[model samples]
Structure formats: structure tokens, C-alpha cells
Target: MKKANLTKIILSISACVLIGFLSSFATRSSVDTWFLTLKKPFFNPPSWLFAPIWTILYILMGYSFSIIWNNKGQSRKSKEIIKNAMMLFGIQLALNAIWSILFFGLCNPFLALIEILLLWLMIFETIKAFKKVDVYASKLLIPYLVWVSFATILNGSIWFLNS
Candidate 1:
């Protein structure tokens, strides 16, 4: 791929992630207020940890997309496959952002738990689809999946304890 095109891919990937993150900015300041009000599980990690974990996971996801896009095996068939996989990836990403909106933006931990459940399932399917196209793509999603699984459990615990 041309340098410019590569830059576009990187930038595009960055934009998508940033938008997802930025969408929650309005709620971030209120996060503590809402979170502190809730009854949390004893195992909940410090809030400081999530950003780093998500940053690494997002970078991995970007690299995974780059690998698929740059693959020589990407013919019409592969193109369709990659595109579909990327779409699913995008959907799960958007679903992730929705959890932030529901949890922090709307301050609804109960609804957020349900949203994270769907996001977790979608991420699982995304990993499977990604595996079919590129093993690296699937591998790249491991941390994302792991972190989300943790979050899902945390979300449930928070909701249950607080309610």
C-alpha cells in the first residue's frame, strides 16, 4: 500500500476509536459522582486502569485491521470476508461506546450491564469472524475480549450490589 493510503488507514482507525471515546467525554467528569454513588464489588479495579487497557486493545485492533487490509490473499472473496468482519468489529465497538453512554452518560448501571452483555456476545462473534480471515486479527482481539469480559462481570456486580 502507498504511504498515503497507509496513513489514511491509521488515521481512519484512530478517528473511529477517538469518536467512540470522545462520545463519553461529557459524562467522564460525572463518572465518579455516579460511580461513587453505586455499590461496587470489592474486586473493582481503580478507574485509572481502564484507559491504558483500552488504548492497548484499540492499537491491537487497528493493527489487526491493517493486516487484513494489506494481505495479498485479499481477493474478492477475502475482500467480502474482511469487510464483513470489519463491520462486525465496528458494530461491537459502537456497542462498547453505548455502554459508556448508558453507564456514565445516563447513569444507568443496570442498563449498562445488559448493554455490556450484548457487547460481549458481539465481540465473541467478531473474534470468530476475524479468525476466519486472519489468525492475527483474532489474536489481536484477545485483550479486548478479556477486558470486556471483566467489565461485564464488573457491570453486573456493580448493578447487583448497588440496586
Candidate 2:
């Protein structure tokens, strides 16, 4: 790979990881304190699972986004599509972080559930936009979409049970 592409990949991954790091500030304190007191569903995964899973997901998301970002468009229309896709990517990423803040920082499962629904929608739209730019880039987001789908269910369950 060219140096430029490698740099992009690293930067992309770093940015994603940085978001995770920042979001963890909200999560770390609550996980042992507030979150532990919540009424989680029976199927809820173990606490230790979250960090590794989120780390992997963030890496994948960054790599997927890098693929879209590095693509040089062949025409005006193509460039516009790529630009739109990137914008969607940014939106979804911001939503991802916001969900963490709402749930963990504010200790509001109900609000988190609502925000996560929007996050899921944005992720779906981002996947569609990414497909227009690069099929592989879109494919890379499938795991994220699936994970967030499961998370949506989990979040709803938590809120329902606790409310």
C-alpha cells in the first residue's frame, strides 16, 4: 500500500479508537457502580466481554470508513456520492459516541434506547450510501449493523425491565 493510504488507515483507526477511549470515561465509572445495579436480561453477556468487543468493532468501523475515504472518484457524480457516504459515516460515528454518553454518563437507559434507534437508522443509511461508493466498504459495516441491532434489543429490554 502507498504511504498515503497507510497513513489514512492508521489515522482512521486512531480516530475510531479515540472515540472509544473518550466514551469509556462515561462507561468506566458506571460499569462497576450504576450499571451493576441495573436489571439486565438473562442473556446479557458478561461484563468483561464489552471492552474487547467494542475495540474490535471500532477497528472494523475505522477500516471500513478508511476504504470509503481513500477512494478517488472517477467523475463528478461519483465524487458527490463518496462525499455523501462520508458524511453519513461521520453522522453514525457521532451517534455511536452519543449513545454511550446518554446511557452511561447520564444513566438513562430509556433515552439511550431512543438514541440507539436513531443510531441504527443512521447506520443503515450509512451502509446504503457506502454501497454506492464501494461495495466492500459497505460490506465491512455489516458486523457493526448486526451488533448494534442486537444492542438495540438489549437496550430496549434493559429499559423495559428496569422501568
Candidate 3:
């Protein structure tokens, strides 16, 4: 891809990130209350870690998507893979945000755990699909998958301990 094209993709990804963040704004107060009162796992990192970790992961995700977007796959198989990948990507992102809403906005750790588990599965399937198109893109998702798996455990732990 040309420099200009790369710039456009990155900017669009950033906008997506911003929009994702903003969409959860109404729940911020609840997040503050619920997050602070939570009985976190012993392995849980400080709250400050989330922003940076997610920012980097989002950048990697954007880069991965760009690879798919840049592909000129006139082949039927390639087209199907891209279409499925994009759809799964969107679903996983929605799940990610919905987990936050379930946990913080509704103050329901149990439901959040369920949502996150599904999110993890979606992400794994997405990576599997992306691999057929670009190996590097699949590799880029490893950290995200690992982090969410860890998070799933952490979410369960919190719910168990708090209950």
C-alpha cells in the first residue's frame, strides 16, 4: 500500500477507536463506581494498564484489518474470507464493549463473564480466518487473544470472589 493509503487506514482506525470509546460514555459513572469497588484478582493489573494495552492492541488490530483491506482478491475464496473476517471482527468488537456494559453499567459480573467468553471465541475464530489471508495478521492477534483469555479468567475470579 502507498503511504497515503496507509495514512487513511490508520486514521480511520483511530476514528473507530474514538467512536468505540465515546459510545460507552454514558456508563462512565457506573464504571467508576463498579470498578473501584470490585474485588479484583490477585493477578489483576492496575487500572492504568488498560488504556495503554488496549491502545496498542487496537493499533495491531487496525494494521491487521488493513492487510485484508489492501488485498485485491478477485478469487471467490479470498472474497469469502475477507467478508467473513470483517463480519467476525465487527461482532467481536461489539462483544468487547458489551462486556463492559454488562459488568459496569449493569453491575453484573456473571453476565459480563459470559459475554467475554463469547468475545474470546469470536476473536479466536477471527484470527483463524485471518490466517488464511495473511499470516502476519493472525500473529498480530495473539496478544489480544491471550490478554482476553487472561481477562476471562480474571472476570470469573472477580465474580466468584465478590459473590
> Among these predicted structures, which one has the highest TM-score?
2
Enumerate clash totals for all models, in the order shown: 0, 0, 0
Query: Hey, what RMSD does candidate 1 come out at?
Result: 2.8
lDDT by residue (1-163, candidate 1, tens digit) is 2112576569646865685578668458567686777778889998788777777777777767666565545489877887888788889888877888888888888898889999999999988988887887688788889989998999898888877
- lDDT values, one for every candidate: 0.78, 0.90, 0.79
List the pairs of residues colliding in candidate 2: none
Query: 1-163 in candidate 2: lDDT tens per residue?
Result: 2122888889998999999899889887698899989999998999888889889998988888898889888999999998999999999999999998999999999999999999999999999998887788788899999999999999999999999
Query: TM-scores of all models?
Result: 0.87, 0.96, 0.89
Off by over 4 Å in 2: 1-4
RMSD of each: 2.8, 1.9, 2.3
TM-score, ranked from best to worst = 2, 3, 1
lDDT score at residue 34, model 3, on the 0-100 scale: 65
Q: What ranking emerges by lDDT with the best candidate at the front? A: 2, 3, 1
